[model samples]
Target: MPPAYPRSPRRNGVHYANAAMTVLLGLGSNLGDRCDNMEKAIEALAGLPGTSLLRWSTVYESNALLAPDSPPMWDKPFLNAAVELSTSLKPLDLLAATQAIEKRLGRVEGERWAPRTIDVDLLAYDDETITTPELVVPHVGVRERAFVLAPLAEIVPSRRLPGTSETVLQLKRRIDDSLPAWMGVVNVTPDSFSDGGRWLKDDKPTTAQLELLDGNYIDIGGESTRPGAVDVDSETEWRRVAPVLEYLDQHFSGRLLRPKISIDTRSPTTAARAIEAGVSIVNDVSGFANRAMIEILAGSRCDLVLMHNLSVPADPSNVLPHDCDPLAVLRSWFGEHLEILERAGIARERVIIDPGIGFGKSAIQSLEIIDRARELMEFDCRVLFGHSRKSYLESMTKVPPSERDPETVAVSANLARRGVEILRVHALDLHRRFWRVYQRTA
Candidate 1:
């Protein structure tokens, strides 16, 4: 008989039944030698002690998800594919392994959704339903990403999402479907990864810039959370963000051009101030666990972006263990925070969930979260993806942060195809370009 499959390690130090878990992972690249990146990623994955790559789907070459009118330099070809893995490592442990592989393959850190040689994601971990502070199984974005579902259906036609009973093939059938509206990114900071300080300059509407927006989301941030970014006091943050909020209110209020503005803040004071300034959305980079922030939004009609963040130190040098799934941790955090928001009087529809790309995460962990974004949707909230020019993209490409737009657009299109309502990007031109492409194809 084949070797008995190892059992799930343990939870709270209790052993669970030993079962072989099959995980579906998606990989893609447009920079360097794309095929080589996928091969290296697979090689790295095979080195994991308790895992083996079982099968892979044919690689598909798709058009870059940017506008035809955009600069020709911005459009690059992408190679998309998916694979299945048989592993004994728990969900979190597998995520850690994938992160290690990404780092080893020359993934530098910086920017949101830049291009790279290889990107790997955990599409599913068996049929188990898991919700932890660090991980949510079934990846929240799977139902919507064609890059993921298209490749996944090729490999696991009969596989179904754990909770919904929707097979991979069924989800792929709707790849051409369109959403009610496009989700927009509102940058509240002066130095965000993508379009730093582009919106709030001189407290005036940058019509040239605003004309490029593809969707109606306006993600406004006051603080710069980029790596090595300086933390600012609420007063300083207010100074930076207030003008932009006021400008939006003054120019776009009650207009058809008015996009939904999401305050990208972690501070209660900031959230309060932005909401009061006519901002209807609250994107708390720090999972909505901040009691003060929750209290402020709970009383108002603001939509919330509850992202997963690991406060615990994630030293890149350390190999992550099965107990460290960030999605699981995020799930636990969401449960607690969801109740808190409900108790504080925040309506459920006003909530959106983000996996918090790159916030306190290793490169591999970020990739895993993206792969498993669909799993996080189990919470029943609209999913928002803000991978625009994040560090993971830089890590994968080994390129400087400023030059990752093509890569970022590719990721955005992938996520948008996956069903993500919002694609938080820094470049309005890029967003418009991709949106046009998506519309034409969709």
Candidate 2:
């Protein structure tokens, strides 16, 4: 009997928790029963093994950062607070748990920066600074959001924002009303909200159009992302984008026009063909989760743009809200894709990240991502914003697809201020004008 299992020892029925690690989290609510949502969040946090709730700062109320264009359904007040926790769990595990709690608390999805029932943000994880795809230990927004800064200062006066070489108090001193740039819109799709398919059937694209680009972007996609659009096959997409690439190669030959040309597709065959045809970038809207697509891009001499997309069905009626924060979700999704890319031999530098402005996100969330585009700079790769004329802009301006140029230009200017090097817009002339204005202002 296997030596009687070494004679089972008598049990005292005693259990001990693991050594606790210190963590700081920012908690806020603007939905039903704000106080209750926060309290529940605290309880959920405490329920995690190897964690102990230390203290929470007093809750403060604030207005939504970017209010939605639609009329308010109710007087939704925002509540903000901070929590200190002692946990034996590793930083990533703790963060995963925090996200789970947020989803559990009826935090319905909306646009970026939209109000919510509860928002739990990891403020800091010990004194360490981490820069992994999964976790940026010192949260990216630590120094920017006054709501987060005020409560954090109240609790941890001596604490410093990691990687900044500044104390919490010092960071607070620099806080202001400004927001950071997020992602630029690159529409490989034909009928995208902003530019549409002006470059689709090219006839020497006018200088005012794609011809004037500084050869700085990764040529994006061929599908149409306009609402109620039909999806095209790999062959159709290849045909749609091939001429544009061939033209670029012919016109800007030997000039290093743009460092790379990106093929935006979900099909492995398309990616492979694009690569064979001299495309230098692979902007996969499906997030490179497809094994075949990953294999095609693996070890290739092309850069990749990994955009976020929900596998779930999307509803057009639910516009993006002003308080929806997808940073954590994006972080998790990127971490998964990064591993896939790495296994496929893609260099880290060749990778770019897009939050997928309107793929499956609400309008408010899109705006929030745009407003906080700089937060993604923490990833240390070139950021691409593809929000040219997305539904969010349409929702806000009430402009039909053909008439959204002015709004798109305004958004582009805002993105430029956030240090976005690549702005993928629809109209080449509009982009050219925007660049001229940007250069002058800079």
Candidate 3:
């Protein structure tokens, strides 16, 4: 197990004197009962022991900025408002109190882009600059997010960002707030067809795993659903992934921008455990078939990657549905399954379709999905293509999985050009470097 983390600010040597300071907070909600949720949070905020509401901004409705790289689906337009308050609690404690309100209002931390009942963002704290691993005084996204600023400008138009002369209005008009999504793959199984066990250290992410996963999003898994792979029991799967989630919550708790943690498991038990441990996205190969699985997402805002799968039983023996075009079949599968999710209260905008690249595919079938992914866009949600280091690439390039970095990059570049919303990958470093180069010169 990783080292235990101190659970309190005082233990970490941060002093929150019995001092009261005026603060700015941004409130938002998109999930169930949006306005009511915001009102509930407002009431809770005013009721905080050391806090008194001074002023609030007009509520604004804006499209959710789904972070660039990982789009399980689109996000609902958020209703946002900012408020000014005087609080006697320290900054960190104030944060803790706001988070408690979020939890009380049934907001479960899942994905970075997941909608919620209420979101309380600490925009600023009495002009006191704070830069710690866990908390930054001026919320990092405040400048770039027009949703935050439009409402903030309503209350305090002349507010300045920490360490900057620009007012909120100036920063809002001058910032490029596009946050790209990067999907970093983490497999805990010993037998992933490609990089199985490569990133695991004693069933938890090693130091190397941590270094490579220092990106925007992480797709974590316990079982390897490779071709002809045997199923591990749900208990075993939960055990493997739970510790990884714990490591993320403990270690990355202090980063300025934390990766949105995702759990790539089909078992409802494992998925629920991951959700409890702060995972936001579900990469289920079973296509979220069971009500138990969908119910795990009930009342909580979580992202779902509903990939197409037929399992190892139909693995390329050509004994499967040879009747019609596979692409049409997959599209029908999406239409039917998506309707099921919608009826079950899961939004289409919160689901990304992956046409199961290697699960029951020939190299040709996988390539077809890659070449013609937008057709699957008929579901009206973002399409994700997870062809990262799969056997189909080997079928095309005849190289070992480890040596397929160039091939993987080629696929990713082509997909980006073709408008794929997200690309899942085992090696984030190579793609990240290539992306940097392309951005510099493109």
Which candidate achieves the best TM-score against the true structure?
3
Residue 255 deviation, candidate 2, in Å?
Answer: 3.1
For candidate 2, write residues 270-378 as lDDT tens digits: 8887777776567777787688887777746566778877641234653434354577667777777777777778765567788888777777778878898877765
Deviation in Å, model 2, residue 230 alpha carbon: 2.1
The per-residue C-alpha lDDT of model 2 at residue 38 equals 88
Distance from true location, Cα of 201 in model 2, Å? 5.8
Give, for candidate 3, the lowest lDDT window spanning 10 residues: 1-10
- How many Å off is the CA of 440 in candidate 3? 3.8
Instruction: Tell how far residue 375 is off in model 2, in angstroms.
Output: 1.8
Give a tens-digit lDDT track for model 1, residues 250-280.
Answer: 6643232235566777888877877766666
Scored against the true structure, residue 157 in model 3 reaches a CA lDDT of 50
- Which candidate leads in lDDT? 3
Sort the predicted structures by lDDT, highest score first: 3, 1, 2
**How badly does each model clash, as a count of residue pairs?**
58, 38, 7
